[model samples]
Target: MSLLGPILLAATLAVPAAFLAACFVPRWRDEALAWQWLAPVPALLAAAAALVAGPFDLSAPALKLSLRLDLPAALLLAVSALLWIAVGAGVLRAPAAPLDRRVAVSWLLTLIGSLGVFVADDLLSFYLVYALVSIPAWGLFAFDPAPETQRAGRVYMAMALLGEAFLLAAFVLLAAGEPHGSLRIPDVVAALPVSPWRDAALALIVAGFGAKMGLVPLNGWMPLAYAATPIPAAAVLSGAGVKAGVIGLVRFLPLGIPLVGWGEALAALGFVTAFYGVLVGVTQPNPKAVLGYSSVSQMGVIAAALGMALAAGDAGAPALVAFYAANHVLVKGALFLAVGAFSARGVRPGLWSLLALALALSLAGLPLTGGFLAKAASKPLFGYGFAALLAAASSAGSALLMLHFSARLPEAWRYEATASPGPLVRFWPAAALGALVLPWLLFPFVGAVGDALSLAKLWDGLWPILLGGLLAYALASAADRLPRIPVGDTIVVGEAAFARMLRVGALFDRLDAAFSRWPAAALALLAIALALAWAAAP
Candidate 1:
């Protein structure tokens, strides 16, 4: 491959890292923040290279950096890069008032990790970038005045750390299982199926990635987290950050290995999450939070596809799955931007509502939309049976949930609309338009256009939406009767998460108090160390 490919790939990573580093320096900080919108340019450029020229590999011996971009990584990176740039614009144009430094730094840190994960080729680099992608986003939500935001931050951090721990163990097991000392992802995964610790590695892999993807039982954090952030932050996180989990599954799971038992179990879980998110989402009153549940449901569909791909031993699963997720990146980002902009003054909530309705239903795989191509491309993987039927139902379920989202949009703007709004509102239309048309350009990468347009295929994509629309209409009147589940439904742990944060804060307090008593602190440290040693002793 040409140096342009490798340079573009390296630049994609280096630009974000360099920019983030610059933000830490006092002199360049605000400028760096303002310029954060420009941060994704290299990534966009790299994606352009990947799209036009195919996959590229880059290695730095001294830095032990190995980055690889194939079709899957390229596709996700391209769409995700597009999202970051688009949303970053909205962030820059947010208001004339000085932007918050914390938000700026947080955005850059998150962007560094977010862009890095797609092309990261080795275990160590992946873990580091994955951590960047998962953590540090707390800054975006942690400082919110609302208790729900703080509570959500607590839960989100807990989940993120928990996922990190599981993934670390999995990576360690994977590395240990590979006798050759190779840390490259492909090499480690190549050793997985026959590794002595195969089951342990796979289990951790699934659980870790599952948490990030917002799979059920672990899904409560998403609504709280997404709803907590400002519009631009929420847009990027939903559209791009969440896809880290999708990429994680793509990277780690060895498709075409016929691990049927595990595959089936994950598929079943995915389907359950799919229905559960929709059921719960409809009850939610907040548009952002409802979209959060839509995320839960949509993510589950992606997971189910991965599961089905695993069961069928389909090597092509990663590309198809990435295509599905890429579509989501654009659509979800655009929708969240729309939600943010709808409340702006002078924007007719009613007219915007109509526009928003069309944008939101794209999640349901509306005909001629990006989501439809995503569904159609991957339909055959599930095949003609119970699995396929569930897949079809998921489209309808998505429709039903999105209709609920549309229904709830007005409620979000109930008291916020007006006749004069800021410049941020202007970007929404462009973002929404991009979400709508961008997928068609990328669709040819995943599947044939003729097949996507075929009468039977169109019908396959069409009926579920019709059924869902009917179902939505049927339920519209009864929405009042639908038991409204609080956003972050069943979030029993937010308090627990908050409690833990409090304890940690208290510990810091005690540490500060004890620091003045140096002798006592030393004794206490020695005692604590001995206690830890005693606990580990055989």
Candidate 2:
């Protein structure tokens, strides 16, 4: 088992890399492109092995390879792998091969990083995989000629670079704090609380991962990016790619030992983002954009959960948070594919819309859905406090936003039928079905399914949804009165800031030109030499 564990871990990463390298060979490029979906198979196998084998470490002391698949990571890995496979199947099912070389390579690289993140044990490995998952995604949409596509690509890539900067700085501080020079996550986390750079590291860690999760200010890129990308790419990116942040929090933060101030601060920021996403989402007319805001909202809920757990000093919280996030990975991923499926059979009232509706509402914690199981399992961690009330209220907001999704999708597709939904329907529905059913299967791993179904518990899940539904109905007439915000709301500010930086660059350029004149350059060098000479003389 020990021997097989590291081999499986290595294979999971090696397979994608091998295929990605194969893409560069001209003769193999087409075939490699066609089989893009096959890349996640080894990861699926590795996740399964880890599920059975428990934590595994590679014996190479020099490489410092250590990987563990505890229940939290295993849960996320399984669903992420499943999302990749389902999306991949959708690609392969197309009559003509759907991938160009650029897209195919980008997809494979993103998949490798997405899956690698779950099992990454050390700081350097995590950072490299994290960058892999992040930076290459630009190629997915970068070449498109449309202005929004180009703009989305630019914004996304910029935000990704900014996030990488924050996380890299945090990792350096973390390594510095560790006297033993170990880069393993567990070791770094153990040293974080007492380390000299503890606050700085933790702050950067939260902001870094929070950017990936679509937390406010860092979030403006998602809506534009998703709306611009093709649906299948969006599916895996939303479902699998974003969870990298959640896992970062789960792995990086010192959750077991509570720091009340930091915890409360995180919880406060989370709640603000939670409400912010939904309120902004409600005004969005595009279903895809709505889902983007919803991601922001949903991720905020996850952040809030982590924050509360940290406040309580609960060691068991990471598992519960993982369980919640794992369900989202499936549900959100499936929802993206469902959008594609619905557009296929536009104007037809079939099982797809109904299924999509159920799935959308599931995100709002509809009773008996996987979301309910997730919410209930994590309920104890929130305890009886204002944070708990905020958690409950967030469900109302989820219900409201999802109801907006439920209503908007069918309306858009009611008259736009042209594409035959049948070709991809087979593949997409499998994802939707899996999302609905998998949480039930995973329930026992977190807590009992029966507890989620008790009369009181069912009501606990029911009221918020009812309130949101009623509010949604009440506001139906006033919907148009709501302001129409752009997809990336705060992005306008970011863009302006970037513009100012460019203007500053121009100013520097003019100064550099002046400095290149012989007299100017001679004076600068003479001043520097004189200062040095004077200091030495003194």
**Candidate topping lDDT:** 1
> Where does model 1 exceed 4 Å of error?
93-99, 349-351, 414-421, 493-538
For model 2, residues 1-538, the per-residue Cα lDDT tens digits are: 8788778778778888988887888787777766767778877777777666676755455776666667788889888988887777667433224345677778889989998888888998899999989999888777778778899999899889999999999999999999899988899999999999999999999999999999887888887788777777888898889999999999999998988989988888888889999999999877778888999998999888888888878899988999899999999988876676666653246667778888998888889888888889778878888888999999999999999987877654442222323545566666777888999988787788877799999998999999989989987989978998888998977788989999999999999898777586788899999999999994
lDDT (Cα) of model 2: 0.84
Lowest lDDT sum, 10 consecutive residues, model 2, at 412-421
Instruction: Residues 1-538, candidate 1: write the lDDT tens digits.
Output: 4888899888888898887898778787667777778888988888878878889989887898899989998889998988888777656533223436776777788988899999999999999999998998888768767676777888899999999999999999999988899899999998899999999999999899999999988898898788776777788899999999999999999896888987898899899999999998888877888889999999999888889888878899899999989999999998877776765543576666666777787888787888888888778778899999999999999999888887766566652222212445787777777787888999888888887998888888889989999999989888779986777775765656878999999999999888767887788998999999999999
- Top candidate (TM-score): 2
Candidate lDDT scores, in order, read: 0.84, 0.84
C-alpha RMSD by candidate, in order: 7.6, 5.9
Q: How close is candidate 1 to the true structure, as a TM-score?
A: 0.89
